[model samples]
Target chain A: MEMEKLYRMHSDRVYSYIYLLVRHRECAEDLTQETFYKAYKGLEAFNKQASTATWLLKIARNVTYDYFRRKRVIKFFSFDKGHDLETNALSPESRYEQKEQLARMFATLSKLKKDYQEVLLLRKIQECSIQETAFILGWTEAKVKMKMTRALEALKKEFHKEGGHPNGTIKRI
Target chain B: MEPSKEFDELFEEMKEVERSEEAKRNTWLALKGRIATKRKRNIFPAFISLAIVAIATFLIITYSIPSETEQSAESLSNEEIIRAVLEREYNGPDKEHLRLMNDWMKFQSERNAKNQEEYDELLESKEYKDFMNYYQTTFGEYFTENMLTKAISTVMVFKYHYYLEDTDIEMHLENVEIKQEKDHPNIYRPIIEVSLTNSQGQKIFHTLREEFIFSKSEPGKIGSYNVAKGGGSIEFREKIENFNSYVGGNEDVRTPSFRKTISFDTLCFNGKIFENENTQKNIHGCTSDRKKINSILKIFDHLPIKEATEQESRKRAEALPQMDNYQIYLTNEVDKGTTFYTITLYEDGVLMFAPGLDLGILGDITTAPHAVIYEKVKLMLDEFSDN
Candidate 1:
């Protein structure tokens, strides 16, 4: 059945998607359980309008966002620091060549706010198409393009500040 | 300008990621439980046909029974046969049968109220508490997770106790219960209860009677408990055999709700579970949100004073926000389904036990109904302690 195929194809990807947002292995596991429950319960609502992957992606994204909004708002409302960035381990000496550039880049990206982060992550990391990104984000394709461009431009300016080249120093930050 | 391929890879590398095979398996199992429940609910349509059959049978029996003497035979011919067949049909060595048996027992419980009362009296006797405590300490580790959630419109606290014989093996708690209630149709009020118990029987002390309304995750609400009457003092003491018998059919009940319980040999602290490192890791790992983590730390800030351990201090360090400098440590152990959370908070090198804010959020999410009722009793106890 198509249902079984959808499960085989998307289960891992959906698991990966949720694993990033929750950060805890156990919670991501629980949420993944919940996401699949929603998918199976609403299978009748599939409509075939979107691919099963996209449909499941929407459900997983919604679950992650719900958790983020509920759990993140109460504790980190006043937080300016991105919890994700702290988890990144980069030594200063190794990346001295591009330290300022990367710092500027992150600083700029962080400053632009949460919406920009979503669009950038969707387009660049997830490699979602402009339309797919928009659909996932409930934005128009034009909006996705505009946001992606802005995020990229912001990153470029940071690179330019550090000498306009990556230089392959391979520093950990 | 777009990020170059190299930068993209770098960004990907920065994405902190770790996957656990155990966690994946847990997820799949939970999904399986949900799917099974859904399938069970699919019998709703069939219930209508059953209703019709029952009605027709009742009519025939009523007309055929000319005297009260004929009632027993008709009942035997009808109800007894159905009950017998059903009991036989569902008599497999499966969990579902156990669950049905549990349900049947519950349905049969009204007539057994006297027995429950006698048991309650026996337990309430001072002799019983002493005997239970003695047995718990002398025999082996005893952990109990009684009342998944209690406190409908009042403060709810769940309790777990861990006992050790040789090794200080104890209960660990992992899941928190969150409850949301509606007075009218639209208004939603949230309550919470903490659920922690290890596979072995250790206990966690979560008192529900305290005032615990954290920030209203939703606004335009009362933002506090405003009830007229009928709430307080959720009791956690019950006969284990009876309690286990109630939920014996459900295999899910057998799984340690908490991550792991340390044995008596592993007792990091002198007498209590608050001293274990593994317990601390499990508590922090339970919730991924920094906000919730901070909220938990805030709760820890209110616990009554206790001596600290290296492992305990280390556990608190793990919970500290990377950007902030508040020392908050949480350690817990679950033995036999009872979970205990030992939280120590330090600020600027000072210790503190954050007072009650009524954490009944766990009361909502817990699937167990009796546990919810019991949390209300905990809420009352919290008030008593405050007084």
Candidate 2:
């Protein structure tokens, strides 16, 4: 029961973070499960300096990074999964605009370099602190800031130069 | 710490990416099954029984006896403090009074010069009395016996104020920083960036950095709240929460480790790269060849640089590079990492692209007081440019 509760509390964030890296839902799910398995094994040594969520993210990042390091092959991660959760907007038109903007945002995000994508996702989207981001990426805090500045510039430039969305919508899993 | 305002909306949407319930359930079930197979908490039943008994005994011993002192809010973790603030159970009236006090501060400061006599006069003034009466009437239930300490119910406005009564507030806390003033061990300055919006077609902002000092004597009360710009109100620094502290939690939380200060680092431009706002960095990669670059830039060192007028400085600092200019970026690798800054050289002046800002120059002409008049900056670029 305790394990299920912990998974329920944190699985989505872990999955989403992994998904952001892999851009594949099934693969992200598998990796997330792997991350938990690893985390459970190491649970006895968990440090309390950071929050449980931050610790999980740190683990998830390593699990994902290790997967890439082992695979070394860049799969063409197209945004072909076309499903979105219902928007809470009162107006249908606003909801559609919100959905389209989100789609456009994700599409633009996909175009950046993988490191840029991770920096943007972790810092800007996930809203981690410089310290927390450093902890997750295993980079120094200054590196995180520098990467964030560069990543924001690249993302902004890409956002301005963004054209049609050839990659289909995100399924939001 | 944040992208510019335009990205805030998109980030808000992106953060709403929810794992579908189906996927979450499947992942959870799969993880649970695998974990059960791997460990199953082997030999844990007796240990679990011991832990439960110990916990129950500890709880009974801790909470059963009547204690003279209540727990201090300082003992709560940052998460608990935020959660307590969000609970709205005891904080509704407390926060509302804080708003009242903040508005009163604004009103009083606007009306009078911020001297002690003026403050005392304001306190006796009819407006002050009316404000006091309004606070008492609205929040008397929380602090009927005591009138001085405003946040008796817990929670204070801190470094910045919110016009809470003017609008309904929906808040999301992103981070917490625990700052301490030296020699005052009991004072905690917990800073947080809060995203606030109003439900009633009112003023809304994306986020705000609010820092408030929590006193051990009286938790959730205002101190050093002089947010009014240019207002040197001495009374603003007065400890407003001198009342008794009350909460129920652990007694010795020991002021959750002081926030980490970013160590001063060896940086480029004699640490000029560190001046960019919003980030405290420890970078080691100064361009080893800067002496070579600066030697080429020696002409401007002899120019009647400081004689330039404010207009000239402004124009040169902000002006676009002349058409006759040479352009090159002096890249200083940050911490030997891929992140580096580019310093631009023009025929007339030098422009260093300020990191953490959009296409603006802050430390121009090598952060010189005057703009460049000589071609030596371009010569400096020429000495190094690939072209």
Please state the i-RMS of candidate 1.
7.4
- Alpha carbon lDDT of residue B59, candidate 2? 46
i-RMSD of all predictions: 7.4, 9.6
Q: Which ten residues in a row have the lowest lDDT in candidate 2 chain B?
A: B239-248
DockQ for every model comes to 0.17, 0.17
Model 2, residue A126: displacement in angstroms?
Answer: 1.2
Name the regions of candidate 1 deviating beyond 4 angstroms. Answer: A1-7, A72-111, A158-167, A170-173, B1-6, B11-18, B42-387
Docking class of 1: incorrect
lDDT at B276, model 1:
47
Question: In DockQ, how does model 2 score against the reference complex?
Answer: 0.17
* Cα lDDT computed for each candidate against the true fold: 0.39, 0.48
Error of 2 at B2 (Å): 9.6
Please give, for residues B79-157, the per-residue lDDT of candidate 2 as tens digits: 3553444333212334654655666566655775333344345544544344344433332222212221323212232
